[model samples]
Target: MACKERSKGDSRDGDDTWRNTSLAAAPASRELGKAWILKRLVHHAPAIFHSFDFPAFELGNAFEDINVQFTEHGYILVGRSQYEAAEGPAALAPTFAAFKDNLCSVLVVNGLEPVPHETVVESSKTATLHRMKTWRGEGVNLLCGAVMEPTRGILVAQQIADDDRWTYSATSTQRDRMLWFERVYLPCGRKCVARMLLVRRPTGVATSPCAPHWKPRRRGIAATPSSLHRNRLQRRGRDSREDGMLVRVRGKILLY
Candidate 1:
């Protein structure tokens, strides 16, 4: 499922580097899902670049389902196992660091405004790429691929937004991916903070709204995740709570 997004002209060794490298995976939703996945992937680059050991955040079924496909051309990384096997553990930190540095440079210099989420969702195309400034004033590139299937969406993006800098790849399975959508993303609000608050629940906390043990009570009605989400919000009075701080960004009422 992995393929390279290469630029027009490059050396044979560069080509080999593309063959050797790959990226991460993403969520399938337009507004929250696409944005959430992109931010996570951007954060992940730095973590992979700095650490020799594979981080705990990169493990689990949720991450495993996401394959970070690059939009430009350069060397990203393949997978954890393939990377370690082919390049040895020592090559990881330095190689990933190089990729991160290069990508950051491009994003910082050539960035543009973020495309609206509604535009991305409404587009009838295979993919949509947006340009925007990061909070740090660095540039960010956002690419949301179309949801060809109802249950899944793919995203490919880079920070240093150039066509000649980084290579990307992807792989997928239909099974556990659905589990990720159900368990994690379904309970979230319009922004990423909802998931973070949900994750901070204490151990043995069964009442946490996103508790894995909780299930829908409506026996006869088949429910979509969104409906379940609305139910959770209404039932929990999540619309207004001490924990749900009001934030002003994008003219949206984000329940942080």
Candidate 2:
């Protein structure tokens, strides 16, 4: 079963864009019935956010038997023939959940730090709106979304590159939506690199650890992302190395 964090919200169109979408093969966990099903749910944003300092906690392991719902882009995305989710979302949860949950701990992010395994996301009464699912080959950018209160641009966008690394980025949009981008990216057995661009409102700019600069976008202008100056090629390249690097910025680690 694919673990989905759904919250109450009015449905809206798909926030980001997806290309080369394909569902992944069911995991072996589903066949054995080892899945995390919803037990108790809170429809409101956790108060932890008001004072979250990268606090770590478990997402209740009281897996119960319930009618788990699988939704995409705010609605149920029915599978086409062979791509069907025969056992419902739970069956695919382990595969997608494993791939997504592992990203935070595996990758060394800048500016903001990812909670231990912040798999259970937090979205205003719209957590469900933040999720997205788009499979590009075996790589999946399963997690993406932000609150619509302080809008930005496109809500979500992900790409699994040929070089084994994956990039998942999102922007706040005008529309209030419930979106889930689920396309887990597997780095095989190689050391993988995941760079999550964390942001809150449109003006919620996180400094690229290397460059402590913040320039919010105006109208249609694009905010400049952190770059590696040619002079610091070898010196700055350590950010993407195996053991993570420290990013000096105080901000929320937005999902990617």
Put down candidate 1 lDDT per residue, 216-254, tens digits, no spaces. Answer: 222211122344443443454432221211111101212
lDDT of model 1 at position 212: 29
Residue-level lDDT tens digits of model 2 in 59-114: 21111111111112111111100111223323344543433444334323211333
The regions of model 1 sitting more than 4 angstroms off are 1-124, 150-153, 163-256
Roughly what TM-score does model 1 have, to 2 decimal places? 0.21
Q: Against the true structure, what is each candidate's TM-score?
A: 0.21, 0.21
* RMSD to truth, every model: 21.5, 21.2
Candidate 2: where is the Cα deviation over 4 Å?
1-91, 100-103, 106-228, 238-256
Q: Any idea what lDDT model 1 has? A: 0.25
What is each predicted model's overall lDDT from 0 to 1?
0.25, 0.22
Worst ten-residue run, lDDT, model 1?
173-182
